[model samples]
Target: MTVGTAGDPVDRSRTVGAVGERRLIVELTRAATADDPSTTADAHDIVIGSGDDAAVIDTAGPAVISTDTAVQGRHFRLDWSDARTVGARAVVQSAADIAAMGGRTTGIVVSIACPSDTTVGTVLDLNAGIVAAAHGLGGRVLGGDLVDADQVVLTVTTLGALDGAEPIVVGGARPGDVLAVTGNMLGASAAGLALLIDAERRGDVELLRRHARLVDAHLLPAPDLGQGPIAARAGAHAMTDISDGLVEELITMAAASGTRLAITSDRIPVGDEIRSAAAALDTDLRDWTVAGGEDHELLAAFPPHAVPSGWTRIGEVLEGTGVLVDGRPAGGLRGWQSFGG
Candidate 1:
């Protein structure tokens, strides 16, 4: 039975019951990808669907591959987000990696692990997220695996085709290249995290609405996946997705190219929401824009004359090493270290 529909209500009259993996997968596929009406130009080569031991995918051009794994309590909180959100996030992060390589997403293989006591409805809801995210990218869920574990885990692998375009790598920028950023870097997710930690400490009802927006960003970030290929088409010399903090990723680019990244103080993308939130929380806005990770914005180094249509120029690539913000040394914080603890 479907869940979360307006009229077709779920039979939740009984307590949540454990369902076996194969049956849970059947229900999840029925609700998520099987009935999806989404179509994309890139997803036509799928010869088979899920439930098979192996999936067959054909690629016309250079195939690009990327994978991401999200585990409960590490990547997300069960209390903060639903299964749908978790599933969608899994696909988004993987798709962003493909886009960062200047390729179009063609297919996705999702593998999920959950506790034996997990409800069938939970997996179904997660499938909804996985399907929605893939559809948004004009891609499809080719196949996946379902297994039993102690906690919810999703390991998503994405395949893409370059369509004859040059695969952009990490170290091609030259001196005097202009550094540009695509998408909002307003630290909405970071602010949302802060608000969630201290939400009950405040009585500002009006602020709660705004708080939810930031919290939602933290829980389910929607990166501008389209900006990547756009940057590539516009002749981006080097590119990297901002999965880490802005400056942290820039440090990577600088180290790769053996150059210096000089960002201006006024150029980092900080909007009114971030500014006001920082003031309210007594936190430096720069810390979030420069050091906070998981914004997933795309950063590219372009020739000064051609910076693309929608990208914002935030800095320049100079002949040196390390990153310099307003001519001073920065990027001291190690951004988003997984397995650090």
Candidate 2:
């Protein structure tokens, strides 16, 4: 059901509380499905979408589901990013999980909680971001709920279709498997975050422009969404999304597969975009490239000859436990940890 055009008139000055729940849902639905033609869902697949009690979908095989949440001041900040980017980032986080499981994105249900005084325009912008990201993945926004809260919080649950392929789990890496990663550079998102913080403090416009890619990586990361299934088709035995830092993920993969993953620091791809940012910040490049997190790229273990195109061979699985860099044990706390781990 189409609501209104993107340029249609609306009261941007009003708060969500002033607009009320029924009207807010109407606006949000319009933003999700009707703001742009590209964002519309395939009617046959989405049996029922927004403006309903629940969403119903038609699937060919088993459904893979994953959910992620973003909170104000924790996952994002209004001063650092616009509402639209925050919305898109939330969807990417959830979709990456589905992709890691070798599933095709089908749909998403979003739930947001924010202060009643939040502007209607901000909410609409956020919905538009969510809808656009979902559409890019050949999916749609199914339905969602919005409520009042002290801080803005977004929760996104994504549905995926396996298309008759076996799910690529994280526990199947054999000792002789080849460890590879998607082409997306590691630590760039962390580098972007660091650049954003430093640039804002020093008011360095030139530095910001020089490393815009790093900044963009943090604001809105576009993972290789298609590579997960590609890896699966290429005979990948184990896979994972590198959201919580590469080292942390590597450690988890090592333990889960009961094998050691060993690689050289020089072999890990650190793009010039990240290198310049690290130099500008006067920090160790490995901090961003090794211990940094939130790249959202896929890491998988494949047969030596079955590694897919557009992936970088980073390491090898050995008959041992844990991860090693440069033939030494990788130690110390790395990447993001909740509750200050």
Off by over 4 Å in 2: 1-9, 35-43, 332-341
Write candidate 1's Cα lDDT for 119-169 as tens digits.
666777788899888878867787777887888889999988777779878
Regions of model 1 farther than 4 Å from truth: 1-17, 37-43, 200-207, 331-341
Colliding pairs, model 1: none
- On TM-score, the leading prediction is 2
lDDT, model 2, position 232? 81
Instruction: Give residue 204's error in model 2 in angstroms.
Output: 3.1
For model 2, residues 1-341, the per-residue Cα lDDT tens digits are: 22222334568778989976667787787666674333344556777777677888886788999999999999999988999999999999999999999888888999989999999889888888899899888888888998899999999999998878899998889989999888557888889889888888888768778988888889998888899888888889999998888888888888888998887767777788887777778988777776777888888999999998889888999998878876777754552232123
* Model 1 poorest 10 in a row by lDDT: 1-10
